[model samples]
Target: MSERVILTTSSHLEGYRVTEHIDVVSSECVFGMNILKDMFAGFRDFFGGRNKSSQAALRDARITCLDELRREAEEIGANAVIGIDLDYSEISGGGKSMLFLVATGTAVKVTKV
Candidate 1:
């Protein structure tokens, strides 16, 4: 397919029919904040406010995960991914903060209805 892969959180796409079930694809990412970012985030945490650096890190992780998912789907000749599920966790310990994200979905070949 020449177009971008359709991604949906729902079980199915509205106007497309699944013609082939290629496989289930997943992408995982691990991210960490730098010392400066951590210091800033820690300061914000002390004040009980939103941490922009942490938020940006997570946003980047999610975007990277989705991009990887799309790449995998395309590699399998899939035009869409449905039933997408996202999992997020903080893997922090020993005075270090880290973020982990995983994205999973069913890769399928679809045709316009």
Candidate 2:
């Protein structure tokens, strides 16, 4: 994997774990994320206060989803994930946020060519 084949795409693959070392591409997508943040802000506003708890929760969820995506790429023998993009939206009746972590890159059994 030359890291040049990396692309941005959402994927949820099973049976994989993200390696400690990963190359995160620049973020260019905000459609899904804007929705989530707006929803969260709305909830907080109506409640007459800030909700750090909610913010933290969403953060964790996003990380988990992204990590899973990375793991999938690794399973395919990708040296690193590039052009990674993430989107997040509200789910669970506006009570919870759904994170969409997408990545595209070349998956190959690297060799000393």
Candidate 3:
């Protein structure tokens, strides 16, 4: 199995030197909202409270996006990814609503300093 790729939002990783700049890698994940959950969330919104189900869906989307980003980095022979950026958006105005998450970073070969 491939090792877990190091990921950081910062420009650099402590104790690791970027030796080779591989390429930019990105991954995106989209999750459809459940109608039932939406109804519940709509009720909660009326009450001005947090919606647990929506939060959980957003959490899952982030995790999947990160995993995909790591796989992409590993495919490019990169052991680490730097300058990572994560974005989230909700797509509506259609029959269904969806959550989208995108992760991006620069893949690089790294060595311990």
Candidate 4:
């Protein structure tokens, strides 16, 4: 996709009008936490400070999911996505943990107003 797909949390863009409502598009990303990260997170939990590693991982996952969303929109001939939403969750069990991120939006074709 040569042109960048516009993304907005709002249902409408200020300067653009939607010409076509394509479909809902979504992307999911999951990242595993290694033992070292778990250990550091435990230390942070005890010491009461920010967990930089976990923060970075979440940031990376968010970016990846958003990028994938954009790609999906483009693949289906959408020029923009509206009402974008991001969801994050953690899955932990048996001393193993993972971060999950989901990005969703409505793909559409838009024209400048």
Give the CA lDDT, 0 to 100, for residue 62 in model 2.
57
Error of 4 at 81 (Å): 0.9
Cα-based lDDT at residue 6, candidate 4: 92
Residue-level lDDT of model 2, residues 1-83, one tens digit each, is 23432333423223333443333433222113355576767788898787675566566665665556556666655654543
lDDT of 4 by residue, 19-73 (tens): 9999999999999999899999999999999999999999999889989999999
Off by over 4 Å in 3: none
Candidates in order: C-alpha RMSD to true structure: 1.5, 10.8, 1.0, 0.9
Question: In terms of TM-score, which candidate is stronger, 1 or 3?
Answer: 3
lDDT scores of the candidates, listed in order: 0.91, 0.47, 0.92, 0.96
TM-score against native, each model = 0.91, 0.44, 0.94, 0.95
Which stretches of model 4 miss by more than 4 angstroms?
none
lDDT of 3: 0.92
Judging by lDDT, tell me the better candidate of 1 and 3: 3
Candidate 1 lDDT tens digits, 34-54: 778889888998989898888
Which number leads on lDDT? 4
Query: TM-score ranking from best to worst?
Result: 4, 3, 1, 2
Write down the worst ten-residue block by lDDT for model 2. 24-33
**Each candidate structure's count of clashing pairs:** 0, 5, 0, 0
Model 2 segments more than 4 A misplaced: 1-43, 47-49, 92-113
